[model samples]
Target: MSDSHELSRRDFIKVTTGIVGGLIGAIIGLPSVFYLIDPALQEGGKDAWVPIGKFEDMQVGTPYPFSFTRVQVNGWERTASSFGGYAVRKSDSPDDLLILNSKCTHLACTVNWSAEAQAYLCPCHDAKFSMEGEVVDGPPPRALDIYEEHRISEDGIIEIFFKAG
Candidate 1:
């Protein structure tokens, strides 16, 4: 007498069904998982040369205000923040320009150019900065932030090398 094992029909069907079900689940589930998390896996750009305005639009000896929105993505969250600056065309030459960030150094409040006062005024704390971004008065520890790296495109657009913190 000998003992032997045989593959039963029910057992074979069960194994086959399990393998097919696993394959189908993997095929459908992988792409759905990736789609749901693709944004989180992507890297957000933190630096760019942003175009603000045309060089010709900024008049000589005056502060020209310009604003732009920057979007930042971290994981699944997306946020938008507004940034602006004053473009003071010091002279007729494109290279002779002063680009200053509109944020007050004291409290990060937006500053506005007051032509009558000949300075930038911060409503938050009465901080003042000259047209060249020099600290004029108030509680500011330093001058307004300035964009030192900038260029005038051949098409006359003013672009500044911007970096996000």
Candidate 2:
């Protein structure tokens, strides 16, 4: 009964060995785990000058649709999301352009241009927006969001400064 209540020498050695082994494993493994995942944990640059199309390709008074993919890495995951928008040339001048995000302000549904109706129509709701991106009717609280910063590159490619929030 006394022997059963007391820890044997072999049991003490086994317990101490397990604790030391576990501590050693954690000390070595934790840093290695962090090192392996450090790149994924760090945030990547989301600001970029995204090329839409050739400046000449965008016709005046017409909405030219364009799309691009943005890849974001979080932890061990990599997600690629596609975003689209419309670019309208207001005049022959390279600076005279209107770049609008396709996402409706109300519910984020993609808005399509109605050539016949001459407005952007949201399928989710009956929201209407003018060619100039102003709200014409329906549930939208404000005008369509525009990419305010844009430039025509020296190669004649139109690019908009895209910044992710």
TM-score of 1: 0.72
Backbone collision tally, model 1: 0
Candidate 2 lDDT, 69-146, residue by residue in tens? 888766678888788889987887767889999899999999999999999999999999999889999999999999
Candidate 1 minimal-lDDT segment of 10 residues? 1-10
Deviating ranges (above 4 Å) for candidate 1: 1-44
Total backbone collisions for each predicted model: 0, 0
- The alpha-carbon lDDT assigned to residue 49 of candidate 1 equals 91
Off by over 4 Å in 2: 1-45
TM-score of 2: 0.73
Best model per TM-score: 2
Residue 82 local lDDT, model 1:
96
